[model samples]
Target: MRNQGSLRSTLHQRGMRMTPQRQLVLDAVRELGHATPEQVCKRVQGTAATVNITTVYRSLDLLEQLGLVRHTHLGHGAPTYSADEHEHVHLVCHHCGAIDEVPCELLDGLADLLAEQRGFALDASHLGLSGTCRNCRENPTAV
Candidate 1:
């Protein structure tokens, strides 16, 4: 999370005003770590009942544009938003829908391979790898 003063300056630099709703939305995103817009809206509304889902979506877009946050597609559902500084690769369990984060360095070798062979620079943090989790694999009936 960034300092409130810096957030205000960033908005001002873009000719935007810093509203309480925006601040709440940002606070929610920071506090929640990784959340969908709906989750953000719910968190914001916990403090400011007037803050709606539309505002959350708009704030998320602006925050992303300002490089304060980033979004990753963890599954087929809505993309999850996290602070831009939260750099990691998400390991998603296909069977139980569990999500785990690993250091971005874990993808360094694959990133280099793809860059050399396919000219693709992989943004490991922007997506998740889906696989059956240990629990699901070890105890098929548990899931």
Candidate 2:
């Protein structure tokens, strides 16, 4: 679990002030581990002051720049946001579009292997590993 207060303080450390919109956005991100901008805006604006999509985008961009938040395009066009700063990898559910993060040193070794085999340094930061999640497995689609 992520500490909201500490995560808020990280904004101060980044020399950024927290407005209601930013806080709301951050809270929504913390609530929904990896959410796209639209999802974030909908949740943050729920029962709160009206917030535009641009606000979500700007906040996410600033957070990502400040290392207070992590995001990945994941070939989905829309970016997903995470508030946890600790290095981790992501598993994206292709069926339901859910995202989960887990810390794995083995992923780092795979990065090393890629570098050695292909001379390609990988940015495995919040890597997107696409597959069906457990939920999807349990509730397999009627194909």
lDDT of 2 by residue, 85-131 (tens): 54667787888877787776658888899899999888777677888
Model 2: colliding residue pairs: none
Question: What CA RMSD would you report for each candidate?
Answer: 1.0, 3.7
Most accurate candidate by TM-score: 1
Model 1 CA lDDT for position 37: 94
Query: In lDDT terms, how accurate is model 2?
Result: 0.77
* lDDT scores of the candidates, listed in order: 0.91, 0.77
User: Model 2, stretches more than 4 Å misplaced?
Assistant: 1-16, 75-77, 93-102, 117-120, 131-141
Candidate 1 per-residue lDDT, tens place, 20-103, comes to 988898888889999999999999999999888888999999999998889999899989999888989998999999998999
Model 1 bad stretches (over 4 Å)? none
Give the Å shift of residue 126 in candidate 1: 0.9
